[model samples]
Target: MSTTHEVTNQVPPLVGHDVAEDPALLEALRREGAGWAEPELHEVGRLAGSEQAQEWGRVVNENEPVLRTHDRYGNRIDEVEFHPYWHSLMDVAVEHGLHGAPWADSTPGAHVARAAKLFVWGQVEAGHTCPISMTYAVIPTLRANPELAAQYEPLLTAKTYDFGLRVPTSKQGLIAGMSMTEKQGGSDVRANTTRATPAGDGTYRLVGHKWFTSAPMSDIFATLAQAPGGLTCFLLPRVLPDGTRNRMHIQRLKDKLGNRSNASAELEYDEAVGWRLGEEGEGVKVILRMVNNTRLDCLLGSAAGMRFGAVQAIRHARHRSAFGSVLVEKPLMRNVLADLVVESEAATVVAMRLAGATDRGEEILRRIGLAVSKYWVCKRAPVHAAEALECFGGNGYIEDSGMPRLYREAPLQSIWEGSGNVAALDALRAMARQPETVEAFFTEVERASGADARLDDAIEGLRKELSNLEDMEFRARRVVESMAMVLQGSLLVQHGAPSVADAFCASRFAGDWGVALGTLPSGVDTKAIIERALV
Candidate 1:
């Protein structure tokens, strides 16, 4: 007798669902006053979680961008070629106004809505967001030079996306990129040696090399160069007004560990034509506007990663069986999934709150709040991804499981915009320079003080830490972590389900948990949390 093995208890592919339709996400949006945009967000969610989007992500990363520096006739033509699927993904993002939607729309919840869209779309493919984020960030910085803004704002805000290499004057739409760090100065832009000589009428000829020029094929870039005064910001267009290529030479592309779909190039500018932005020596002040916005994107990206991981883990747990029971029914595995759900929900809530702050014109709150969120949310992503991947056991270790990609993509958020140390220092600087920022941060946290005793205790401890200035920088990371936890606890107590808040406070603050995942204390409703996270 011949016997055949049957495939039972295998999980189906997670597709054909609308990610925006998530109950938690929709509730968060409603709480944040952006529920009116649910229809549009649902469309984006559907597309992002679709099989086509998954295929696009695979093909784009597999076929990385190729630099074609010279044409067939040996003439210099700096361009990077991407797979058609990459273009399709970009087209969808651009059409949805992910690039400049908030700036273009002046409604009450514009920023919140745009952030939600980005969060949803980023879960599908994160690499293409390089240009989208840069374009969105460039608006405020470009305003420093009203002349430049007048010349390009319409083009940048245009809903259409022109994916051709042409003069900005001829293109229907445009995207922006940034080149700040140099070989000697990774994050210290002041140490850059790039020299800019005055040409004529606020224009300069820049001659230096940029260590990393993200989205190298973008139509324009905001770069830093040394001028007569000091390091200054300049706008460099890929194609000059006369329809000729700029003197920018693409030396080579960096082989990165992840975000492979985007091209990060090292290029030398041999007297590249550039227009000075803002006054000389004010580059840091001007470019900081752009950095702040990108920092917010980094936070949102991390939150999106967490959500993706949590959903995948929950779905896998519900389907796969082990030890004569489904993983979701296993006590320890249930605890792990529930812990991740709490984490993902906390991140989503904090991110939306920050966006709401931006909409409310809470400048001080936004400044410090962004720093706190950027530091903590991005930092938690790698740990969350690892735990989620472990739920699939051996299958998750393979590339086909999609867990490895999420894991690899997790660290980039913490590193980009600003590293953990940088974010913590920035928070401290905000406190020193603007005491009102501290007040704003505390004011937001104190709203939920009386709701949870654990959160109240954590906040009191953080207040004590903030009072002592001794070894502040040395203790910055610990202080920042505490601040992050207190903030998350406060938000959960105020907005999340009672069970979630209790679980978070008990494990995170009351010391009922160990150092790893799956250590939630007994009596917590782990099954409910897992169900909430399930797709």
Candidate 2:
């Protein structure tokens, strides 16, 4: 035996434990009326924490999806080839009904339970959730036309993973994608020049190029184009009802910074047949439904990233030692770990609350709260991920440590649904357009009044900011940040663990924090917050 390769002082692999064991996740699950789903959630958690599942995540990322524009016989197949493990990962996602099942579920808090499960399993891999979320989101938009919804909703919500290029109606289940942005209009979807013409019947012929289309291999897509009336929403499938391929050109797959496991393509639609999902000029209105749902997923995915980083950082500290003492026993390291746990917990609780709002049909609260949280929580992810990775020192910088992957995936959620400015502006827009949404948001925040003085004062300050609408757009980020902190503080004060809430109020609301992470004030209950992560 070689004494040099002893592997001493290394943290053991984190596997075979339930990722759903966290108290905050479980507490939110119950509070949101999804306690009945605890057993099912644990099942998902166990599989997500398995070594085999972890390997599936790693293998797919290493072997990115390959684009197959043609067959051996020179036929334009327009397909994407993923590593076998990618399908395995997607199979589990579909089998667990993470895609569109919640829309048809009779269970109480269906969306909330699904959101919690997504937050749990996304820790395994973050990319595949993109299509799953799209499929889930497209259901409502597809309902803009009753006939189309009736024809496809069953297959869309089916709990089966039918992976292939086929007629969407014949497939037992379906996966969906979204294609709207073009080079001319990045976020300004109205500038889309993709023109659509009526074919005398109900179908329309679309001809234009998409700058970015996620999950290109999906059975169907919710697309936008300029129709005779104006911008319109339509449902386009890869294979037509007559069993022939649509006139779609797979230009090229994007070389992205991360999320390589999922295929994003530049596509040209050459008179592709599409059925209008909504009336002409209502494309933006219809597609916003899909955007809101995917935004919820952005929140979940970022929270899950936080959880992944915290678990890895804490697991390493518990075992590895320096200065002849365990890292967890050191004072400074403890503050860092506790702060990470606090951030993760705040994100999880608020995300689940929004999910619960969706389930309860509290549209006012969801509309405003999502935009606020999306701006603040997602913006925090990259910073949180960097701090967590630093806890492992040089070791975390390596690929095998998994911290690099987490760090790479962190910035995506913030960039995906909407960037910081867009999200913050959305919150302000919601406040102005739908004054009731702003009222609903504050009503929820005011629940914990008198429970914590810092929270009460924060709420008061937030009100003052809202009253003075001067320079609102310029101060959008600051106003949204205040709203997010107050809402999170209220939730923690009301439902979260006492120590976690205390730490959140002291550092986030009161002026007891530093600019960077791991700067919680002294005398805070570091031990208590860290134990919440351990459980």
Candidate maximizing TM-score? 2
Off by over 4 Å in 1: 1-5
Tens-digit lDDT track of model 2 for 1-535? 8998888898889989999998999999999999988998999999999999999999899999989999999999999999999989888888888889999998889998899888888999999999999999999999998998998889888989999999999999999999989998888888999999999998999999999998999999999999999999999999999999998888999998888889999999999999998899999999999999999999999999998898889988999999989999999999999999999999999999999999999999999999999999999999999999999999999989988888998999998878999899999999899999888988999999899999999999999999998999999999999999898999999999999999999999889999988899998899989988773
TM-score of each: 0.98, 0.99
Worst 10 residues of 1 by lDDT: 1-10
Q: Give the Å error, residue 247, model 1.
A: 1.2
Q: Model-by-model lDDT, in order?
A: 0.89, 0.93
lDDT of 2: 0.93
Error of 1 at 136 (Å): 0.8
Please give the RMSD of candidate 2 to the true structure. Answer: 0.9
Query: What are the per-residue Cα lDDT tens digits for candidate 1 across 1-535?
Result: 3346666788999999988866667777888878888889999999998998999998898899999999999999888998999889888888888887678788888888888999999999899998999999988989989999989988898888898779997999999999998999888788999999999766899999999998899999999999998888999999999998899999999999888888999989999999988899999998998999898899889999999999999999889999999888888888899999888988988888888887778889899888888999999999999999999999899898888888988999898877889999999999999999889889999999788888888899889999999999999989888888888888889988888888999998988888887798999988777778777
